[model samples]
Target: MKPAIHPAYRPVVFRDKAGDFAFLTRSTMTSDRTTEWEDGRTYPVIDVEISCASHPFYTGTARVLDAAGRVERFEQRYGRDGGRR
Candidate 1:
């Protein structure tokens, strides 16, 4: 690998706003915002709307869509016999 050609990987904090969760990790991404971490050191902070902590799939709180009801309504409106002679 060549020097000065790759982005620097440094410690940063990712915060999930909805879940109020945060973690420290190394990433190439840059941010203007900073926050003091648990280690008493300042690091770049990135705010996210959703993360594994708040995701419906991971939390097992997904909502099921009513597909059967929609299909039944469509069939009723279009006619059951297809209007064929």
Candidate 2:
């Protein structure tokens, strides 16, 4: 718990450039950019390429692998296509 040893933890805005989304949060990151928030206060703004707002996983736009189809294809090739053992 040494003073002045830690980076500044302050409120900053993270803007997702692709998704056009922005949010305010506290972090130790610094930025040379500043923007006026909805609260009429100027804070350091960091532009990110992707965020939860735009990420495929978080946005539920990710393409799910067809494991079941592959398994069925394998079973058919192995002579186990729903036949009784």
Candidate 3:
């Protein structure tokens, strides 16, 4: 409703250094870094450490430990591994 009060919601390019992935989306963030986009227009280029592209959880690269096995081992020492009843 207010003029110039809201941030610029334009397409932005987010680059991941390690994963070598670049995603384009609309964002209100501003940056000084510029790069040539697919449309042949140069825009601000922002570098990010992690995103859904590089994150372990999103990529299913996260290691899942066996906590249940560890709990059973601990119960065996406490003499409660025979049954749960």
**Which pairs clash in model 3?**
none
Task: Please give, for residues 1-85, the per-residue lDDT of candidate 3 as tens digits.
Answer: 9998998899889999868798788898899898888889887889999988889999999999999999888888776845656
Alpha-carbon lDDT, every model:
0.93, 0.94, 0.87
The sequence of per-residue lDDT tens digits that candidate 2 reaches over residues 1-85 is 8998999899999999999899999999999989999999999999999999999999999999999999889888776746656
lDDT for position 81 in model 1: 68
What lDDT is reached at residue 14 by model 1?
95
Residue 35 of model 2 has an lDDT of 99
lDDT of 1 by residue, 1-85 (tens): 9999999999989999999799999999899999999889999999989999999999999999999999888779887766654
> Which one wins on TM-score?
2
- Return the TM-score for each candidate structure: 0.73, 0.77, 0.72
Model 2, C-alpha of 56: deviation from truth (Å):
1.3
Q: How much does candidate 3 score in TM-score?
A: 0.72
Residue pairs with backbone atoms closer than 3 Å in model 1 (clashes)? none
What 10-residue stretch in candidate 3 is worst by lDDT?
76-85
**CA RMSD per model (angstroms):** 3.6, 4.3, 4.0
Q: After best superposition, candidate 1 residue 61: deviation in angstroms?
A: 0.6
Total clashing residue pairs per candidate? 0, 0, 0
- Which residue pairs in candidate 2 collide? none
